[model samples]
Target: MNKIKLVLALVIFISFTALKTKDDDFVKRSFDAATPLYTSLLNLTGDNFKNYPHSFLPNGTVKYYQIDEWTGGFWPGSLWYIYEFTREEKWKIAALKWTNSLESNQFNDKHHDIGFMMYCSYGNALRFDNNPKYQQILVQSAKTLTKRYSPIVGSIQSWNQRKSKGDINTWEYPVIMDNMMNLELLFYASKVTKDDTYKNIAIKHAEQTMKNHLRTDYGSYHVINYDPKTGKVLHKQTLQGFSDESNWARGQAWGIYGFTTTYRETKDKRFLKTAVKMADFFLDHPNLPADGIPYWDFNVGQAGYKPDWNFDPNRFKTTPRDASAAAIASSAMLELSTFLNGKQKEKYYNAAVKMLKSLSTDQYLNTDKANPYFLLKHSTGNLPSGREIDVPLIYADYYFLEGLLRYQKLKK
Candidate 1:
């Protein structure tokens, strides 16, 4: 009788497990269509964005043009991530070519984006091979970043004199919302080099952001005004969003990811709590489209009178389908979900699954059987240049792969 009871229990367990696996497999099938689309982008871009290069201007040029400033470097990093997943030599060769191109830009002290510079290039290379030079490059980049920290503000300024001609304009000081996403590189540098200074600076920058960058309701602004001398938060403004007062979709997404990362590093409940709050705000906002993707700006479809003119073909509106935001937010959701236990974890897990499904099936995904770039419709570099409106964006491809990898790992 004991043997029979044991056998019966085993059978029940196996049967129940199979049913859950079947259900999970069914849900994962939705990603099947998107997987190849991502793989195709890796193929077409050819490791270094060579095949579908950043387009040239009407003057017929072919230099390293970018869609936007904040994440243009992320393009190569994205390719590296795909290579990490696929382990294809083609991706590696492309990544090497792109990293080679970035050499001249490194240590130039032009921009405050060491994360984009080191994380994708040297960071990826170092991970694969214990190369001393890559470590040197990352250390040099970190030092350059450290120099940007203001004693007053305790944060690295985003724009530099290269843009302002040694003016030290207040507009250039203080961390932009996007800088939070890149701070991880510095934190990583600290761990690899066994240096506390890098970690300290990175944390200080985040603390400054918490005090100044985030708004009353936890909706963050894109830019903050700082007194360069005192490092004071003078004012906060929303440059690219609908209004200085209105919420920007991408900014919210950045908050969701950045704060969560900060919390992971420090284990500070405030950062974790802040991340959950922001994530909740993003998921709960009525402005979000039914499909889980968001408009470029929250005020795009407000209940007021229509705009005097519809979106101009020549001029891209500040508000439109921002697939990039959705992709980033999806990755953040996975991270946030994994950290939580029990019911909270399950809720975020389901939401992330939903977002990924939406992204897979959404009309914006350019799954044109013939088109090489899977993520064709993405908006980027929206403010400075009106180019690449709702078109294939390289970063979109990058984040989609990241989110997929996160989901795949969660299942295990």
Candidate 2:
């Protein structure tokens, strides 16, 4: 390396480390304080709840799933983050206990969320401590996930034809941008097992999504219905967003996160370029509120309805904010910022900081424990289905904590 380049690298490191001190302390202390409440929830619910502990009802009871649902892994994953942030033994115990619940998912080839279900939980454990047991579990999970991949489509199928909502023939081998987030597990499995198949699947899936899932504006759709036999795209629509053309905040975040991870795993410049483009569209979108968090769907306007960031969701039901999307994007951006430098790096880092500030405020955090169920509030789940609307979600808290930790990492 050139002498001048070495000097400039030191300068950037010092600047990021200086910022890390304050932000790192805040995230560490906040999560440390919330640990007891999370533990209490785990104890109270125990194995009594059929599904994973995902969210809470208005009455404060745990919202759970009966089986290995897509979200079953977040609770354990959050516990792992808690342990990583605090280095406490209690959290490790909690993480192990919760992660063990999903052990059966290694055989669950029914859905395309094993990465979310397994990698997020067990994957984190192996990242910190290379447990041989965890390695086998993750590799098995990765293999099961690849079963959904179709050579005809050149991508892993996200939903099964048996599970499609409409006429079974209407949607054939559909893929969603969200599947991009799961590629990390395949990449991980490849490295640990020394098998190229996992890596190839991840790369191929990314290529397909990059080709068919993105709009001209670089925003992503919720689903891309593909003709399984011929690898032809049949339909592009937004099931969660307000309209087909409307970009769902969470879907865009998923694309940003997915491609960013692709860049990290493959070190491919195209992946980094695509991730930056996704960030540009998300952060610079016209409908983005001044507060930094986004509405559930960016296009949920009254034809020409202007967005009001401060509007009370209780009063205006037309548009609710998705804190979950903001949380996911914030974490991804902090990591993305590290991969770039100059003004481009600063742009992503600043945007992540702004969103973190908004989320850490009293407006978002539940300080008084009025909701022992969750940490943040007003996270929209699925507005179209009238489910989990304008409420706290488990994935929201998981990503928020992860984002804070990422912010802490950047400063260090």
Candidate 3:
């Protein structure tokens, strides 16, 4: 018994040391990698740092948008992450400048992504410095976001009634799984203001999502359209996914991230289990790429009740990879790993490490300064629209940086 115990103890020590080395290497490489990008981004955003970077256009020029754009907050948020990582005054200056640009978005209640916009940027900014303005900005952003919540639907509204080329117009109120990520701002708001209203709203939204959004195997649909008056689910569909029935890779990641975050805030076991199940669906799926990234949609080319994708995973054809999804999932998985033990913990932690290692490769990371300023490559956005197929994306970089920071924090 003593001899067996000694061998097991030796194995555990070696494994832990190896993981420590890998984690340390990731933080070092990540810090080195982000420095030049920060310099480039600072110069690129010279005057109009408020303009949210969407992605690089095909011609290799950078594209920027207004605060109302969903992606507007990530640039400033990335600035905050780099600032925290490097402890440099230059990054701090740029982070403050860019974060302050979105203060007015606190009044914009047109959508539910204020969490992503304000919390991610201002939240990180507040972490480094406790500015009263940042606090007010976050509280106001949460208040504005709660305005979109309907007591009937029990979930915050995701998309406004807008006519688009896709099927986003088919519902009175549509709540996608991605909205789960927005609750972080509400949680923050509840904590700061000592108001349970914001917390209540967030919990209701999460409960509604748990009841309606997931499939039997825990994979989630993209959108759940509802009857606004009665709060009954009208139909489930997909907007950015392969088909209405298909599981979009990024959507799954968003669900897992959101639930894990919710579990973090509320300590709800249901949220934790749901998050675990979603992670399993993403990690255990046979279609998942060997490199740890995923195809745009999990059900692509596989037969289902209503299969929108016709591409096969094993006998691969031309399918786009979603690095953005992988980054998001890895970040979420790292957090989830903290909540588990034994083999389950190893599964998630190792899966996340595998993904980070893969993303650090040349195939994904953009080492060339001449190309787009975006970090990760081959991230898909609205494949049905044929827009931004296999290109660098802003949120991809944001989450990649966020994931690296998560790994670093876990080590500490």
Candidate 4:
């Protein structure tokens, strides 16, 4: 019996050691892959922080966007993640250069994405350096964000109205599921300033979103249009999904991530419950692929879920998988797991690990030697608009690195 027990212990020790090494290698590869890719991007962009790398064209070239674009912060946010992982001064220098370029946006209250633009960049900077200037900038951003909020709508307006050819407005007080993500800036401002005004606006926006934005199955609408004066919901539609009723994969990911952040900041059980429900809906959906990536929309091939705007029958034959959604959800799940215990925690943690593993594979990890500017591939952006149908997206890489770091910390 003693001899058998010794042999079993030796086997278990070897297995555990191998598993640890494998996990370590996986994380190392992610950072190794990112460092060169971002270095190439920096080389291409040439210290010009105003033009941010957004995505790739069909011809495999990099697409750049200006500071006013919604995706401007993700590039700097990715650099911040790389710095956090490696603690290299070079990465910090790059991150600061890109992040500081957005300082003037703190007063630009044109849209609701100020949180994404400022928080993702400056928020991560504050986490590492704890600089007082970053705090002040974030607070100013939160104040600017508040300008878009309507007391009647109880939510922030996502876009300004655009006049069509016939002089009809496109939308009235439109709020998107993506706006859920901006609440983090408000919550952080509240925490740093010891003021409840920012916190209260965030809570009210979340409450209104919960009531109006989510379907019975917890699938979120990409956009919710409300009457600016009456606060009554007028349209529950989508701008990017297969149809107004279908669950857009990235929108669901945003819901899960945002609600999880809300729960973390507020400890409100309502937000926690909503986050879990949204996560469960995404994970358990029938349309999600075996590798955990999702089709651009959950109802992509379904009979009634076809979009009227860009109805491409050929595209449905090979629907693009959105690695960005998986990355975002995996990162969110890791954080969500921390708030749970027992089997629930294990389930989410294991699911997130599986997602990270899937994303690390060569099929998704962007292994082309000829083009090394992007991290992950096969991300679908604005499918209905016929844009970036299947390509590498900056935000996909941002969240993938974030998921890797979160997983590393949880493992330790």
CA RMSD for every model? 5.0, 5.7, 4.1, 2.2
| Candidate number with the higher lDDT (2 or 4) | 4
Give the best candidate by TM-score.
Answer: 4
Per-candidate local distance difference test: 0.68, 0.84, 0.86, 0.89
Which is better, 3 or 4, measured by TM-score?
4
Model 4's number of clashes is 0
Tell me which residue pairs clash in candidate 3: 301-309, 301-310, 301-311
Q: Per-residue CA lDDT of candidate 4, range 298-373, in tens?
A: 9976987756574766855587899999999999999999999998898788888889988888888876753569
Regions of model 4 farther than 4 Å from truth = 1-11, 163-169
In model 1, which regions exceed 4 Å deviation? 1-72, 161-174, 301-319, 369-371, 374-376, 380-387
Off by over 4 Å in 3: 1-23, 163-169, 305-317
24-114: candidate 2 lDDT, tens digit per residue? 6557555854687687777777765356777778776878875568998888888888888888898888788778777888989887998
Q: Per-residue error at 25 for model 2, in Å? A: 5.6
List residue ranges in candidate 2 displaced over 4 A.
1-25, 47-50, 162-169, 302-318
Put the candidates in lDDT order, highest first.
4, 3, 2, 1
Q: Of models 2 and 3, which has the larger lDDT?
A: 3
Q: Best-fitting candidate, measured by lDDT?
A: 4
Q: Alpha-carbon error at 158 in model 4, in Å?
A: 0.6
**Clash numbers, per candidate:** 5, 2, 3, 0
